[model samples]
Target chain A: MTDLAARQAELVRALLADGPVPAGFDPDRVRAEAAALLAKRRGVAARLRPDLAATLGDRFRPLFDTWARENPRRAGESFRADLDAFARWLQERERQERERRSGHRLD
Target chain B: MGLPTLGVGIGWRSEIDLTVERLPGVDFVEVLAENVSPDPLPESLRVLRGRGVPVVAHAVSLSLGGAEPVDPRRVAHLAAVAEAVDAPLVSEHVAFTGAGGLDSGHLLPLPRTREALDVLVRNVRAAQQDLPVPLALENIAALLEWPDGELSEGRFLAELVERTDCWLLVDVANLHANATNLGTEPGRFLDELPLERLAYVHVAGGVRHGDLYHDTHAHAVPPEVLEVLGELCSRVSPPGVLLERDDAYPPDAELAAELAAIRAVVSR
Candidate 1:
């Protein structure tokens, strides 16, 4: 294959290898779920700062790749669970940021 | 197929919305169909059309060079806009924008070979079938040269015209920028093209990146490109020559001055 074709194939392979985690895989699911949650949180953080969004996609993509690989057997369930946890975490984090901005203190 | 040669126009950007509506100077405006589409046509474009302004449709996102089938959806969208504005001419770049599910984020040059030409011809034929008027393809600038084993740029373009029977929207600025950046001879490139096939000419300004000059289309037309355009006009005698200002857009006042300069050069 030509260099361009080779590069394209490599990208497709990488995406495919990072498969969905299977059902009832609790430990792997928890880890992948946690990672995806963190990623969403980071995305929210990046949005408030444009430069971070620009630079972070590359850095953060590896995290997803790893999570996908770790939960490869139960990739779908784990990935979704992690994503749900991440979204929950992001909401809480955003609330805290808003509270902090408003000078509200937690005991 | 034979569009009247309306001499020296400018590509109207929506950013200059208020300016374009108020000004009556530019001989004509090349309206970007990509910007105002699927959404209602803006009030400004309607006013321009009503006032008998000759608008030419210029499009983006055709992805003509990509592996995917020509998106009939965009063609329908463009065809509607052309009829609405009564655009005498429509044009797009002869470069691919995205490939392999990754957005390249810019126009990417195709290798000038039979394979690439075949791809281009197929796509153009598909587009022209849907479009009311002939579709002209613009030459794009690139940093990398094809790894030989390909047709010359001129030959590829000339053959494309012959094969597809499409018109040429020659961007003199892109040709000049590519020649300077790629070390290709501009004069020879100009000479080899089928000038009679050109429907219009686009001239713009650019910046130098390292040793290579980039087609930024930011500034006023450079003297050399202008000189080349002057020569091109005499040789081809096309009806419309447009000045494209995509970045660092000068104020309408400054744009008027540039348009006046173009009018002088092309009319001469």
Candidate 2:
């Protein structure tokens, strides 16, 4: 990658993927920005996927935020695709919870 | 200099479609380019356009400043929307949204270096070629700055305008946030910009989150943000001013009153 592209990737990674604060940036401010960016993404996605957001109800934001912190958005992925991924993540999590409740562990 | 005068307007969201329609003296409306499709226009937008109100397509996913080249499909989508709505111009942002393979999901600030400027210029010109109308780039508010920026925000914007012949969509609320959080001088920042190339202005609401002033379009337009709008008005009569309220929309009367406040500033 070129220097400009590489540096932007580092910054993007730092914001969305819990990467390091980079060489010379202020850690506190960047952290705050990252938190804000995550929230904005969640908010915009929620607006786009009103059905999923309504289905998830109040848990939508917290659940999505948690999943987002881990999943992070892939560049060039459409918002529709990202929301679908969120829905799938929610389904998997629910299945795991149900299995645990039934005392049946499955792959 | 051929930009049309878009008296005063508000952002059109699905949630506030009716409110925007009823808002008195709404000269025009800007819709999110990503949310709209040219094939089948939304009924609400159709009604607004019927009333002779212009709709400007404001896109967020262009990533014009990304080191990676601008996406052709995204540019085409924005152009189609502009042609469908007959927008006098379209506006994106001066900042890049994401780069590489990870999307930050936020309009991140660019390091104001000449090398970065070269990348932005190339991407902007390429996108401009595909666009049917003039393209105006908005200045975004950033919570943090990249280390070792070679140029100030104003100088960077000036150079972009000079090189690409693109217009600007200056966000007054963002200027206020930068002034409070980054100690950016509003006067100097305005002076350094080429206002003649300004296509329009965005006035939104922001609130203070400790030391940082968050440009939350969900809140009421604070007096300080209005002060910045007033400052810009004093310098030059902007071609148009649009109010942006993305979330927690107030009542119809309240939104109208906010528009009135903006009208009051520009008419000063």
**Poorest 10 consecutive residues of model 2 chain B by lDDT?**
B97-106
Candidate 1: which stretches are off by over 4 Å?
A1-107
**Stretches of model 2 off by over 4 angstroms after superposition:** A49-59, A104-107
What TM-score fits each model?
A: 0.73, 0.96
What is candidate 1's DockQ? 0.05
Best by DockQ: 2
lDDT of 2 by residue, A6-32 (tens): 999899888988888888899988998
Best by lDDT: 2
How much is B75 displaced in model 2, in angstroms?
Answer: 0.4
Residues A16-100, model 1: lDDT tens digits? 3332332323334234333433343344334334453354467545643443344322212322354455445446756988988
User: Cα lDDT of all candidates, in order?
Assistant: 0.67, 0.91
Q: Report residue B100 deviation for candidate 2 (angstroms).
A: 2.2
